[model samples]
Target: MTQTTEFDWRPFLLRWSGEWSDWSDSRSDDETRSEGDEAARQGRWLGFPPASEERIVAMEKRLGRQMPPSYRQFLKVSDGWQHAGGFVWLLAGTTDARWHDNESGLADMFEEDLDEDAGPDERRDAEIWRRGLQLEVESDATYVLMDPEDVDDDGEWAVYTWAGWRAAPPERYANFAEFMRDMHREFHSLRAHRTEGEPEFANDTTRELDALVEKARLMALRGEWERAGRTLDEAKEYGRPRAVGLGDQIRRLLGQTYMVYFEDVVTDPRYAPELLPSLVAEHAAHSYRDDSTLMFHLRGAGDDVVSSAYATLERVRDGTYRYTAAGPFGEAVERARELARWGDTDGAWRTLMDALPLWQPLGPDHLAPMGWVADPLLGPLLTPDRGRELLSTPRGGQAGEAPARSAGLDADNLTWLADPDAHDNLTSYRFVLVEGVAPEDLPGRLADGDEAALDDPMTSDEARRRSLGGQREFSSYDDRALMSVGRAGDRWSFAFDGDPAHFDPRRFVSPAAAAAAAATAAGAGARAVVVWSGLRTWRGNPFFHLSVARDGAERYAFTYADAEIHRTGEIPRALDPDRFFGSGSGKVEGEGHAEAERSLLEAVTGEFGVHLPRHAITNGRLHTFTSRSWTRAPGNGETYAVISLNLVRE
Candidate 1:
């Protein structure tokens, strides 16, 4: 006969499940007797064949060490539960090994003595005993059943406890190669339930590890790199033994966070300096690569970041940035540098002015260079004269003209009159004249006396009335002369018809001194002087020739009448000697002859008390002459006709 090979099912049975017990003494009479009888009738549970006395004795002899009472009792019982294609066994037993009693039999005591009530102290001791028993159970249960092919049937079984039931495939693998294979196969099916399944098994260390891995992935989605890295760290700490390839996961997340932090810093450009060091340190601690480029950009050792940013802009010219929006700081810095180089202090000032409206909300440190730029920019815009002008007048409004008096003549009113540029324009000057004594008293009364009369209460309204009264008589000073005088106490009042021309006393003391002499001659109180000057014609002279335009021998000629100043002397001399004279001849045709002549006479007489005689030697001729004493050079006493003629030909 051929040699027969017999397969012992014992190893498979032991590997399939933990021990089971019948609870022969402790079970209820109906359930225990029935279930035990049923299991015996069934004949095979976990492939043990039957719990016969002969089998027990054989196992004990083979193993050498006495099996714990719990194991014997468990073998005598019905199988417990089935899972993952195998049965799990529950054992019941007692031990007399005192030291081992706490280690192996504590669970037996709890199961057998259910009616025992212990005091707090006894309860505490029982808890301690239970803890020891738990440790033993865990140790006995610890085994990793490799693939079935790896089990050795002939190996010594003395040191091996029965392998527990295979409940399910382990949720995570300890070996990386196996894990990757499992992950690939389960990747899709496992992912659908991961969010719900992970937390359900969260109390298990292995499940918590899975949960953390998922959490890191979710954080990555939200761009929360820092938080993702921290979650990966926790997963590594808890899942080190069971989490396959977790180290790589953690490393990848840390690297991601490092890059993200650098990107954030570069984009914002405004984080506090104190934060940068901490950020860089975190990246370094994580062993992140690519820090060199970030460090160079932030620390400015290699190609200043601002300059580099500007260099990248294609449309920007001068100091202004265009196209992209990320470079205001770079633009501002470039603008400041350009302003400094070009010496455009005012342009710089304006730039800062424009920037203030834009940058007011920025923090002081960020705005520091701008503030520094403003000082140098503004320095050149201010000067003493400009400062005075700014202080004296409204920024962009009209300035106040000289103030006019209501009654008495105010010397202060003469202040603006001294300006030679003052004209008849309403914007130029304002004049107020006061009248008191009648015009008939001018021959004998001093200007000071007239001024005193003008100050009198009774004469104040009269002075105002008279000053305005002559306004309609003369369109301007050139038309007619206006005079007024008043007196009251020591106040003096004097008025003139037209705008007075003020002469510097230092330059022409004669007129001022003569006026003073006249005032002294009249009285010590006040004085007034009135004079009227008009136009005079000139003689037929070559200098006064009119221009003729040739039009085929039919000439069109026109002559302009001009005015001449005769004498600007004392009042008595101007009126008495008849020394004033002028020359003009022939009919004249000119646009502004009358007005120009009147204006010329008024200008000269107003400046130097002079009047020209009104008489013509011709129908009209444009000629100008002065009295013997009032020549081109008054001191030279040379008198002659002066004219400018133009002739036009087509």
Candidate 2:
């Protein structure tokens, strides 16, 4: 052969093998080997092939994109050496180049290279060597081939193209490009549908829920509580499960609505018979676990709701409904009071009895109304003995014992008695008299002063008057002197020196005045008053003193002197003088002082319902000047006095 240009084919071999390997792998192995054998036989195909250009045009047609020139050149080389393993030698100045193994090819080139120095052109070519086709060249060279009859088998060809060939661009183009286009189309279609379609799916359910709540609120704002409650019921149904925070929000709304409705329904008579029970039941169900909320409903429901609340309260008290002790107990007491007020006394009493165990532990405040069971129509149910018994029993360390005598005197009985006159018919009085005689007669003889001598059966009426008249100016027997008359109602009265200018004996000495005075005195000092009746005689003497003290200090004192005059005929005649005063002393004296005192004391204490101790009595003597003493103690105290007086009335 004529000497061929010494071509260093290493660079060309690398580029050609890399390209051919990729293209051949993209095809089936059978196709690649057949192409290689054909190329081997056709020596012209050993160099760059003319078929590469045709392949580029085919790929362009298949991809619908034009091929770059550089990419066409790269494909040409790839097609030429599709399976010619290493190197291809071209005949000098001719189109034929014989393929040879790389090692042999390089060795022969090195041997030839010793004789000829490398030229600039050769060095430049060496520097430009690239093993694999550039991305743009590969893109132009690639095509996804599928059997025309097996279009449905594109997935197999697509995977094969990605894995076998190193044609990443072709793989991405085939899968991702088509996928993104379909996604875009779908997105546009959805956008258009959203813009044009009726918005039925977006219902105003939330708005309906909100509107219901708002309507309820507006009703509340307008004070139309019943309407508000109806609206809230609607709201509860509307907001059941769908809305966020709906349960809690509706619960609160319903709570307020029901509370207002409960109050209005219970207080307004028109609604009490029908609406109250339903409201209470609904409230109980919703607020069962919440004692404070339950309490709100219980209290708001007022008297008409008592029966229902009583049932619920009984459950709460019985531990069926869990609640703080104070809440249920308070509600129970309130309900009981309501029942009692509405003439359901038995029901009220029974309810209270049921609640007592629970309330007792909660202490006095809870038991306040129960404690009032002793009032009027309710009082007959709570007898005095029962009251004392309840009061005496200890509940939660609170002693139910009777209050101190002083405080007890101030209790409601005496404070709220209806009839003041009825008091005198209730209690009795005992009058003790102390008399002073001449110093010589003090040891054994009772003094017979002018007033005293009037009682002697032998003394003439004239003698008694002259004696009383002679001693009257010198004696301390002025009408102004204070003297305990008798117990009347819850109070004790005494005669006091009235302001002479304002004193009208007719009024001051009147039974009405005396009754008023006694009540005033008792209330002023928180002391129960004791009255003395002159009709009650002690050793033929009608004289008595009444005394009251706290801590042994005298709060009040009164004395009644002169049995024949004051005791025999004082109150009855003072009350209605025209009826009995003209009668003789004997006729009046026959009205036993002891019986009157007994009756008066009983009437007063019974009417007022206060207990008075007998030791609080004090009797003083006339002329001898008996002294009574009192010591101040924190509670009720006793007073002592000597009463020595003799009365003889004409």
Candidate 3:
């Protein structure tokens, strides 16, 4: 039941999507009928039937977001599929695939321990739903939640699953595709084992759960709470309808996610006992890595519960995060006074919402101070009589999806177009040809004569690579690409990457900035100018395909938390397309980006006769550079002349 990094989900999605279908039109009547009969015999899964587009659209509207590509396509093949009586359980269909509501939530497993006086209001369920959309799988006992809120740049949400048992924290998969792909294999293996009498994970379901718990324990010891939490959830299902000693041990291990390890979170030697009584006081508000900062802030609160709550609230607004993975929430609001203070304030409204469950154990004496705030995850924390009022809110639309682009260009030449969370690597050819418009007939460029007109900052090639690398996982600036083009003298320079804290990008002052810069670099009479950039993930994964990794330092999808701004009117109307290719505006990546580039080339070559070529390595020359090195290898002596040429960054 532990989430694994070993599966390559892309291939599986393709195979499943194309595997079984309405018999091909080209097949003979007898062959088609036989295939159809066989599929019908297999029933739900083997006879996969794609759901209607209208149905998918309606489902997306109901959920208020898009489903992961593989999941959506899987539905196209089989709107719903199920397997019973073994490790495989219930897999919900389009009709039943809805986000969990306030009433029928898995968190209710904690009901026995919750006090009526201070327990979280119905809205807590709604809040959790905002962060993740739940889909039932496997006997209604286990469920997977799609976390679109914390996605990589490529719009792939990390998938987490939990068994509906008291205190079962969810474990995670890299994406919905991975979950589907791996789950398929697991079911096949489990079924095989059951039929073969192997018996490890088949007939004895409890033993299977036991092995899962062991795996989780090992993961927890190694600091992988997502999988650890996940495996334990599966174990909880094994002991369902009755509590087990094993589940208790699982909770203790999962608790490590929020607890500081053998050290004070506030990091101050002076306040020996931290201001927050428990290590979890600030766990939800900030990363555990910031021990010094947490200690400094926690020290300011002294021992007062109200002070600690307020401080945590402030920090949450200031932007703190739980590192690597999220932790189990709604378990600790035992403090009444602190909850009361947060319930009334604007400063820590979000913190209050996240921590409300902790305070549910308090009496009505603490009720007077509780209230509402404008939050995406806003819940019914206070009773109706307490009142819902406007309060401080984070900037809305932070996670909005990009609108569909209306530019009707046919996708033919291009292979893929990813809405890159940010800039491009100059390692491979990925020249961004903006729009299909001609610069000659338009207004002045986005930038003009002075450096002031081109306000975008320039940096080292290393900076470009670093920015792109970090974005392959989760990053703040994973939206738009600010394509910067410049020239010092005879050589043209360009580096397209994400926005970095240390770098700034120049805006266009005239329609001719980029074109004119290229023309100027090649000298006035030059017929064409070469512009180029490379493609790479932040971790330097090869361009054009998704790479699943255990962490950000390796290849993963280009997942970003926000939408791109490039599709807006930011680029010059003269040189920019209504929507850049690969903006995720109803277009796939590989083909979208490629076709967009091709169309742009057609327009530029036909209108401006601009010649695009390999990237230039040096400021004085245009070519790819490999760090200025040479190796003496044995060579066939056919060519004799020595040559000199300008190089670009390799």
Candidate 4:
């Protein structure tokens, strides 16, 4: 609860009290044991529900803090409202007061790191935001909070929302009163908003016809979205220039319902049978005839769930699916349940399975949009001692635990991982793929037992200096890509920047990445390049990296997954060879190693074939990264580097 200084904010609740009570009466039967039994609560959203005096007192005592008088008075007037004051706040009720600091919701926004491009001022605000008490989840990208440090005995903490998209300091209100007043203004205008939105299909050319929508547009600019949307609806029609020019009104109305719909569809489980179909019906009007437009509106918007839903529904519309909705996630649960009631259990199960990839990145907590689909909703459900074990094995995505190194590759010289010599123990291994090169170029050559290729690798100056003088034809070789023959895992994870906690493992395997890289190399008319990284030691760090093509070589794009590495860097494009191996670079004590130039990641991509856009290459440092220290002594003290697998085109 937040205090109101000059004005009592409780009127906001009083004005909307009946609206909230109606919601509670409608949703009371929706509560179930299944939602709670899922190891965590599912779809916990904001709604105004009845609160008892006794329950409110207990909740206050439990939190060890008194509610701000304005908010406290609000609760007394009408328990707690889910989406109160037109802002997103699932203001907790008496029983829902416990804070889930560990929950993966907007609760994490308190500790969100500054954006990479965040300025000094924005960074300072994030540091300040860490101190605020999170009040509720405003949306996926934002949260409401009361800053305790800024308050005193009056319990008047300024309320603000932490929204990442907003470049300014998170918007703040003087108190709950101001916030409520602003919200009240919009609801009062709903009539005008909707009146202007009614279509005048016959008046195609007159500016007078568009006047109503123009008024609603001003409301939208002032953040009166719900009213603006209703007004936009009235203006909707195929020939209505007002709606067409302003936005696609049919879609705009559907978009407007998203937030309110999230609250209703998630909390009203008892009415779900009818509510779910009605929710889907809102989307039924839009026809997705072209893939490009679909991709633009869905993928380009970065909305995976909606994009997947549109794609899945398209398949159903085209006869590619029989009896399922594989999701935009939230709808899938309802669709699956409906299918089961109709005796399509297999379809229901498939629908649920399709959603696994969607939540995998959210980790094993596995939240559903409407909580858990009742396991025994009458179909033969698979019972297991552990609920999570009931789900199928998920493939590469930061969906589960960090995979331990492959025992086959991280061994004392196993033949399968290619190093038969019981020398330097393998600590880590990554299936390397330079964005625009074939796996046959480097990884392929090393696997072929061509030790001579690396032993007399082109000297630093030869490749860095001599190669720049002319269009030289370097020797090339290729073999069948055989690396996929073994039981190697097929995925690469991009943890948040380089932090492992937020790593999202995906299904892209190395061979596929290599093939992508190779295709790009071929298309660029670049010569094959391959080399071995050996002389391994426990004291030294080893990693696979590909260098970008030098200046004269059509700017060959290679790959390195991380944008930054520990204290080491790529060689400069035009620096002399000696300068690269100098102490400032990867040079070890009493040992020298060449460094390669760092290249911009933007100009290239995994255009090797996969259309994934987030993928980018950090310039390679292949030749310059081979320095190992022999000073360490613990295990069998032998340094090693040998081929694991290599296949190239003959």
Tell how far residue 382 is off in model 3, in angstroms: 57
TM-score for all models, in order of appearance: 0.15, 0.17, 0.24, 0.24
Task: List the candidate numbers ranked by lDDT, top first.
Answer: 3, 4, 2, 1
Model 3 lDDT, full chain set? 0.36
Q: Model 3 over residues 1-650: C-alpha lDDT tens digits?
A: 32233345344534332322221232344553454334543441342356898989898898788886656766776776543223334566677676665334545544444456644433333344445676655454565677675566556677766554635445666676667655654543333323233333333444455566665544433334345556655554443211122233223222322333222222332322222222333343355444455544444344554354445455434323111111222222223222222121121233433332223212211111111111111212222221221111111112112222222121222222222421253323322222322222111222223211222122335334543554434322222233333221122222222232211112111112232322232244212222221223243322221111111122111211112222222232333443343445434354444454445445434443333221111111111111100112224653334333444688
- What is candidate 4's lDDT per residue for 1-650, written digit by digit as tens? 43364455344454344433333333335565342222122333223445677777887788766666555655655554444444454554555544434343443453375567878555545544455555664444556665554555677656666556666566666555555544443333332233334532222222443676676554443334346556655454212334432333222222333422322122233323322322333343254444343333232133444444455445433323222223364466667655443223345546654554453212211122212321223122222211222222232132333222211112111122223232223222222223333222443422334321221112223333432354233211111221211111112111001100111112111222222333342355322211122212233443223332321232332222222222223444442233333333344322221112211111112122111101010111112111111112223644434333343688
For all candidates in order, the CA lDDT equals: 0.29, 0.31, 0.36, 0.35
Better of 2 and 3 by TM-score: 3
Question: What is the TM-score of candidate 3?
Answer: 0.24
Greater-TM-score candidate between 1 and 3: 3
* Cα lDDT of model 2 by residue, 1-650, tens digit: 11112223335445333433333344434553555445544442334534455666766575444433322343444433332211112111112111122212323433343435777434322221211111211122222221111112222111111122442321222221232222222222222233233332122333554566555543333334345445655444433221112222223222223333433324344333333333444454566656465555445345645665556445433323222224455576567554433223345445644454344322211112231321222332343433333333333333233322111111222212112332333222222111111222221111123322212111122222434454423211222221212122223222211011121111223222122222222244223333334333223445433433332133444334432223322232222221232233433344554444444444445533543221111111111211111112222453334334556999
Give each model's clash number: 41, 48, 68, 32
For residue 642, give model 4's deviation from the true position in Å.
72
| Runs off by more than 4 Å, candidate 2 | 1-530, 537-540, 543-563, 566-582, 589-591, 594-650
Candidate 2 global lDDT: 0.31
Model 3, residue 28: what's the lDDT? 42
Candidate 3 weakest ten by summed lDDT: 622-631
Could you tell me which 10 consecutive residues in candidate 4 have the lowest summed lDDT? 493-502
